[model samples]
Target: MDKIINSPYNINAVARVDSDNIVHNHIYHYCPIGRVDDNNFIYDNNNNVVGRVDDDGIVHNHSINNSPIGKVLENGFVIKENALVGRVDGDNLLLAGAAYLLLIQGNR
Candidate 1:
């Protein structure tokens, strides 16, 4: 089953996918960039390393530091710093799904 990541305000759809969104407006599909590691990497449709999400819900840029950019809390709240940024509708959303909303869609 696919999960739709809605805007924090609950107005627009940030992402619609199970692992990657396929909507026509969505130019990029968020998916696992490589082999599953300690941190799951998020890649765009073009296959570039976009960011990563850790088991603890820490979202990181594609860098060695994996600096904290945002977080996907256990309650399905997507946070940037300390602000509520997005929300996932439905359960069991994979790390990549949350990462795309915060790291990619949030920027748009």
Candidate 2:
């Protein structure tokens, strides 16, 4: 679905982009994990299993057929496929790969 997630910077919302990689101005769903902990399951607006994060700070995207998107490093850098995506802010909010390859990519 062509989607765009307009979320608060700290909230870290994920969006499903279209074939052209454009994030349309629409929200399909958001980070079901309002507050993240460990082993949280990510979901779409349809409430389908999108992906998940492990306790070790690894991001796994089931939305793309069980793929390894990125991981949260010790320095609080959220790197996706070796590229610097985002990071955990002071409030410990994980923000990363929304509007790109994931709807939301983080420790959530």
lDDT of 2: 0.46
lDDT of 2 by residue, 56-106 (tens): 767777767877777766665566767765544332223222313333433
Clashes of each: 0, 3
User: Highest TM-score, which number?
Assistant: 1
What pairs collide in candidate 1? none
Model 2 ranges off by over 4 Å: 1-38, 90-108
- Which regions in candidate 1 have their CA more than 4 angstroms from the true location? 19-39, 63-65
> What root-mean-square deviation over C-alphas does model 1 reach?
4.5
Candidate 2, residue 105: lDDT: 37
